[model samples]
Target: MPYTAEISRVNPSCFLFLIDQSGSMSDLFPEVGCSKAQGLADAVNRLLQTLATRCAKGEEVRDYFDVGVIGYGQNIGPVLQGPLAGRDLVSISEIAFNPAKLETKIRKVPDGAGGLVEQNFQLPIWLDPVHNGGTPMCEALRRAKSLLEGWVVAHPTSYPPTVIHITDGESTDGDPSIDFQKKILAG
Candidate 1:
C-alpha cells in the first residue's frame, strides 16, 4: 500500500515557498495592469490565507502545517514580514494571527441579481512586492534544503514537506538541478 501520512496538529506537514524577486519580476503584465512581482505576491498572500483558514477550528487556528517563504533577488532568505519577519518557518496559527498590515480593498461583485455592487473588504499583507538584482535560485534551494533537513528528522512520521518554486527568469547563480539532486534527492 502507498504511504499515507495524516496531517494534523500532532503530525503537521510543511510548505516551503521559493519566490523569485529578480529584476524581470518588475516587468508589467499589460493585461493584468500589474507587475509580475505584485501578482506573485498577491497569489502567495491568498494561498497563505487559504492555508490558515483550513487550519482554523472555531476560535482557534491549529498548527496543521508549518509555512515558509524565501525570496531570491538582491537578497535571499526568509521574506515573511511584520511579526513573522526573519522567521524561517512558522506554524499555520502564527500566520493566521500575524499579518504585516491590513488594507481595505474595494471590488465589484455580482449582487445576486444581474447588477454588480462594490464591496469593501480587508486584506492581510504579509509580503510586499519586491524586485531587484539577479535570480540566485541555486542558493535559495540550498537554503531550503538546510531548513527542511532538520524538519524531516524531527517529523519522521509526518507527511513530507511540499516545495513550491515560482520564478520569472533563469537562475543567475549556478545550475539548480545539480544542487537539487545533491541536497534534496540525495537524502
Candidate 2:
C-alpha cells in the first residue's frame, strides 16, 4: 500500500520554494499584463496564506509544515522578508504570524447581470519582486538538497519534502540535472 501518513503537528511535512530572480523575470507576462516576478511573488504569497489557513486550529496555527523560499540570482539564499528574513526553514505558525505587509488589491468578478464587477480584498505579502543577475539554478538546487537533507535526518518518519521550482529561463550557471539526479533524487 502507498504511504498514508497524516500530516499533523507531530508528523509534519516541508515545502521548499525555489524562485528564479534573474533579470529575465522582469519581462512582462503578456497574459497577466505584469512582470513575471510580480506574478510569481503574488502566487507564492497566496500559497503561503493558504497553507497557514489549512494549519489553523482554534486560536493557534499548528506546526504542520516547515516552509522555505530560496531565490536564485545575484544572491542564492532565503528570500522571505519580515521576521522570516535570513532564515532558511521555519514552522507554519511563524509564517502565519509574520507577514511582511498587507496590501489591498482589486479583482474582477462576474455579477449576476453578466457584467464584471470590481472587488477589493486584502492580501498578505511576504515576498516582493526581485530581478537581477544570472539564473543560478544549479546552485539553488544544490542549496535545496542541503536543506532538505538536514530536514529528512531530523524528521525521518515524516512525509517527504516537496520542492516547487519556478524559473523563467534556463540555468546560466551549469547543468542542474546532474546535481538534481546525483544529490536530490539519489535518496
lDDT of 1 by residue, 1-187 (tens): 7669999999999999999999999999999999999999999998999999988989899999999999999999999999999999999999999999988878899999999999999988899999999999999988988899899999999999999999988999988887667755666
In model 1, which residue pairs have backbone atoms overlapping below 3 Å? none
C-alpha lDDT of candidate 2 relative to the true structure: 0.93
- What tens-digit string does per-residue lDDT give for candidate 2 at 47-73? 999999999989799999999999999
RMSD (CA, Å), candidate 1 to true, equals 1.5
**Top candidate, metric TM-score:** 1
- What is the TM-score of candidate 1? 0.95
Candidate 2 regions exceeding 4 Å error are 110-114, 182-187
User: Once model 2 is optimally superposed onto the true structure by TM-score, how far is the C-alpha of residue 160 displaced, in angstroms?
Assistant: 0.5
